[model samples]
Target chain A: MSAPPNRPVFAGLTSAYPRSEELVRATRDLDRGRAGAGAVETLYAASEKEVAALEERLFTTITGGYLRWNDLFRPIAESWTGFSVGPLTRWLETNTFFRQPVLAQPPVRVPGTVAARLPPVLGQRPEKARVLLPGPYTLARVLDNRTGESDGAVVARLGALYAEELAELRALGFGTFQFTDPYLVREPPDGVLETATLDAYRTIDAARGSSTTIVWTYGADPTPALRTLDRLPASVIGIDLTEVEAASLPAGPEGVGLGLGIIDPRTTLPENPVETVKVVREAVRRRRPSSVWLGPAASLDLLPTKPAEQKLLRLADILQALRREGVA
Target chain B: MTDALFPTQEIGSLAKPSLEELRAWQEKVPFVDRLGPSGPDLLRGDAPEALPDLRAAFAIAFLESAGLDRVYDGEARRIEMYEHPIRQMAGFQFLGHVRSWDSKYYRKATVVEPVRLVRPYHLDEFDFVRDHARRGVKLPITGPYTLADWSFNEYYLARQPGWRGRPQRWAAQREFVVDLARQALRPTLKALVDRGCRTIQIDEPAAGTHPDEAALVVEGFNEATAGIDAEFSMHICYSRYEALLPALLEAKACRQWAWEFANRDSGDHDPYAVLRTLREYGDTRSIGLGVVDVHRDPVERPEQVADRIRRAASYLGDPTRIWTNPDCGLRTRRLDVAYDKLRAVVAGSRLARAEFASSRR
Candidate 1:
């Protein structure tokens, strides 16, 4: 057979910069004794500036650069107007904190709340932008079970809300959408969480029409639930190769695209571009991929700004390396 | 306020302004500029030329403004919780920055050599507050397990063994941390006791970060506080207190356990839900109830604090077993927000005290 197709790599699933920037602004505001309702608006404005600066910095890079939901507090519950945002809460494993959106009440997507809040600089470059989210299953996992409902019951409700959120983004012309399930790797799939997640993916993908929908799984092994993940009606599915043995990857449909999280984001150890190319190349050969995307196994929220930035550059280098090697 | 009701106190480092605030203060304040780039560094043992002792005196006065039954220096001189202690100890050196939570980081130190005391770290800082304080003063020190928990174990990774050729890294943390508690903290506790520091609060924010490691934490606390005669109090924030309660009860040296109940209350506004958890483990240790939510800027209503305390009292079955405090430290908040939260702590404690005393009559 002809040389395997060289995949596109997106190096922008980064949480290091804007969250850091917004945190600095919160610190500045708090330091200046600027407390109360007005500070929230000011924080949002400062966040927009951070976005503009982030876009301007990443504008020259080849692979697509993302405009992140930097101030996204707890995953799903923050969609409601009443779920007031709190301090930068601790993230599991990584040293980074995300403004965890607290889901207190039944989540109803208030108008203007769910819309993408990119600053004009990135907002102008919609082609390069893909809206990413903490998939419904992951969002519902962190939520406290205050409602006395089953996990499936709560997940289903959140799934519907996520579908709505995705539809809104698609309406705004965000053609490429990603829903990341970090918890998929962390928690063994309770049957209900998997089914609810698949349903949510189908609802969003079907509603958004022929747009490219990528369900990127990371941080834990989805090996047990791979078939369920692959069966979801989406254009592409990303698996974390860090958790999967390259040789044992099962054969799959050539039509469904592949996104390999070939680089580890949790460690300070630098990645070898030559080795990264080999990992994806092997997966492509065995799986017979239609399309391939290379990237870090998860969000680069674990690394500090300097290292996270370097990891993004290194990811781009791997793509260039594969292109030169021909069997890409 | 009735003595039978639990008394309120301030936790360590009550929202010290971010270094950003210190930089701002450095630019404006004439005397603090001489202390260094960060004005608060003066509070440590290393202040240049002993800068007139004004800041430590002000720390006591600032806490006195809150009217807490017990007060602390609010850790004005040191950096964030873990770094200050590591800086004072030998063998530990800053390798680089590590993320603790979202965007917040503490300098990750590696214990490359055997740890020893640079000297007694908290005595002079404690003495200033003790002499100047109008309220009873509480000196808060970083507990050893938390110090080990937040650190990168470079030394232990090399030295400790699980079996043949395999270095048991997890077990290594236990030994290294227990060593830090038993041997490392001895000098500071002795020095503080010698200086007549009666109330010692061990700040263990990392105590419940990992639920499985709860037993190790208790072991560390017991080792760290051995033979020090002062009253021992412990502070833990944003953890699964349910998992920790059983293991933490083993820290008999720790007379009271302070928790961040108000901080837990943030996501769910349910008033009774958190105290409901506290009531689950009945009558083992004096529970320090968090009435003020320190993470948020909004000042708590006094009635809300009183109501939370009353609910805690009913469930735990003794009002006296309860103590009052803010959910966590005020370090990341503004000075104004920090003081206001303390005011709520005092005001709410008053409300609860009055209600309890009247009901008894």
Candidate 2:
């Protein structure tokens, strides 16, 4: 599975960045893990170890850049719901292909399969790419029917399930997984759902055979939420630049990757590319992550079909440029 | 004056109607007016028993004093959610609600599935407003295209209809929603028009949601308003108006584009930057410039509001084509805050008009 011949010209990274064979190998390795809590959290724990012999072996076998971003277990763990997950997972899988925009019950997993399917559609995007899954809180908020259930019950069950699935992905081989929990901002000031979200991350951390970065995208008005955030075992927290004023961001995270989402994923308006590069550079100067992954606040689901394509191209351009600057 | 406030049939006061109560709802005095540390509109759904009620007409005297050409009962009779009555009806099915990221207020609404329109305005809801409303009232209703665009369509009609069947259910659904606009909304507009209601404001918050899909919705709206000759208006705000920018210049069914000039995307206090964007389209329709801020509030100074209006007039290149308004609907604000905000808008418009006349001399 060599990279496709028709891969679009990207500006930032090396020409070899879009290697299809490497992506396929990474996908296969990622698919081999067990489908439970231990597998998921162990991935998170293993991610925390500093480039140890064992960690190097795991990252090397996974192709490259494995322990970088958060939500590594998601694409794999959420997929198991195919047999044991909620009704939405079944609906999404049964009706549409992984990336098809139809809304069904959203799946409970990371959608690694969707990631694997993207190279062909995206024309061999960066090899060993990172895929993002909705964070626990956002999942809880949007999927909740609130008929007879409390948010904690939902988080606990899903967390246990996520932990097992995340551990499985580590065993299989995923470079980075980004978990997005935007709903913490929407949760009641002193609510149980917020507590359960942190608990779920801890469960995953304890279970993963090794350390992995847990990324939180779209956390804004980050107050009260950020108070408890640094304590969570996850590695990185992705903040939304479009939603939260950059001034509101905390001074620094101890060792977490600062996932800065500078692009607007929801609207079709093209971002000024120069301004985008400047923002990323400033964040690098200020936050100084061990690494920084540039992307949008969320998926480009709401954009029109054509504009969505343009958005992906723009993002690819940004990432490529960042790689040239050695930031990724 | 038509006797009612809303066109629907579910007449009842969801909240008390009072001019003074509407004036006090702002969280801040001048800047940062809408959202507050304690939160805005938190005291609703509670009762007040202590203060002796003022029985006279003087209590509401400020409403007319504010100088609104057309006024509403400020929707005092209705509660927070606007679409509840439609949802409570037998046929409409419930879909989960969506929240505005900026404002925590939730709009609980239903998806009209299987696509059918049975009747016009709920006669029951409109009758009371009809009886008690002031003269020449403006009637507000959500548009049809917005309803279809907001909800998820279970079927995309991807399947081609064979010999016994028809193809492209999406096209059919689009037509269905438009037909609903014609059957339900159009008649409601006509009823108001027939009753001597001179101005009707149709609120289409969802219009800007999908810019590419806008032209499709506009066709339906155009059909709904074909040959009807009342002063027609469309109110939209808190949105990036760029999507519908081209449509505003087409001079179609709407005679005025009543928009929020002081929203997050529109900029905080100064609306000139936003009004300038619509400069090229000024000749197509009147600009319902929101001179007063509605979100947070100390009432805007007459000078500040007047300044905004003058900016709109300059950018629009014509003072006559610019109308004064608040950025968005005041239903979410406190009653007192809303009244004060409206007062600033009226006073501001007067100052702008006076300035224009002096300049002519």
Among all windows of 10 consecutive residues in model 1 chain B, the one with the lowest summed lDDT is: B160-169
lDDT of 2 by residue, A232-313 (tens): 6765666655544443455555555566665553333455566567666655555555555555554433333244345556
The residue-by-residue lDDT of candidate 1 on A1-328, one tens digit each, is 3434554444345333323444544644554567553765556555545544554454322212222344334433454643545544445542344555555555666654655444343444545555666667766766555455666766677667666776776677666667676666556455776787677666776666756767777755557767676677677778877667666777766577777786565443456666567767777777776677666775664444455566766766776676567434
For model 2, what is the error of residue A293's alpha carbon versus the real structure, in angstroms, after optimal superposition?
Answer: 16
Chain A vs. true chain A, TM-score per candidate? Answer: 0.78, 0.57
Q: Write down the lDDT that model 2 would get.
A: 0.47
- Model 1 residue B249 distance off true place after TM-score fit, in angstroms: 4.6
State the lDDT at A299 in candidate 2.
42
Q: Largest DockQ belongs to which candidate?
A: 1
**Cα-based lDDT at residue B215, candidate 2:** 69
